[model samples]
Target: MAQESSSVLARPFSALTLQQAWRKTNENPEITKADVALERSPRQEADIFVGNLIDERHGGPITIGYGRYARGQSLTEAMAVDDVMIVLEERLSVSTEAGTVSAGPGEIVYMPKGETVTIRSHEEGAFTAYVTYPPERPAHL
Candidate 1:
């Protein structure tokens, strides 16, 4: 038998723009790169930036962040948590086990844990999005 945990009721919440979140994250020195797990392509670390918005400190079960990728920059990693990504600007190519899909401004994508995803900005101008995910689940689960 499994132990039960109390379920919290969901409520309405407020949100901030990508730029606003980015500014807030930068203002806090405690939110370091280690807190924002990003796997960039070789030699492209400087081309990608992630600004965390909501994390454990926010008292929420999920973390949200803003990611910006310079043209020609790419990042690849297996999803450690369920993630929802909403493209706010430019174009992004998301490659997964199913196939590669292209999303432009106003598009949203969902990826599940353990799914390998490669996000690339292939055109002029930077690609931006709001990404949200829950805390990584234990491997034994």
Candidate 2:
């Protein structure tokens, strides 16, 4: 009988096995309660956390900070900006020249430049997408 090889066989890179390939998809961003930090703004109380910030310039001044805010009071009161999109949860109201109305989850509220609006907490709090589109381009621009 031929002597059998006692050593372990070497497997190719393509022969590697995956433990599991499937996973449940979560829609909302993974924000732990412990990770939340409460902040006080003139508008309302905000639980702020840095999500993602994007620099829109080549070492210039245009930058976007993707942050999370949980406002329990009138947080964004009449603070004018360019635009915003609600990512996860619903909000109570968004003020505009036309009128204020209820915004649902995943709603995109586009407030143009100089559009005055106030946000009051109808429920306990709100999860929103904070956008920083300044009125005038920065001097570096």
Best candidate (score: lDDT): 1
Each model's lDDT: 0.57, 0.40
Q: How far is each candidate from the true structure, as Cα RMSD in Å?
A: 10.7, 20.1
lDDT of 1: 0.57
Q: What is the lDDT of residue 108 in candidate 2?
A: 42
Pairs that clash in candidate 1: none
lDDT of prediction 2: 0.40
Candidate 1 similarity to native, TM-score: 0.62
- Model 2 lDDT tens row, 67-139: 3445554544343446454434535455545556555544445555555665554454565544456522431
Clashing pairs in 2: 44-75, 78-117
Q: What is the C-alpha lDDT profile of model 1 across 29-98, one tens digit per residue? A: 7654345554442334557766554666667677666576878877787777777766667777777655
- List the lowest-lDDT window of 10 residues for candidate 2: 15-24
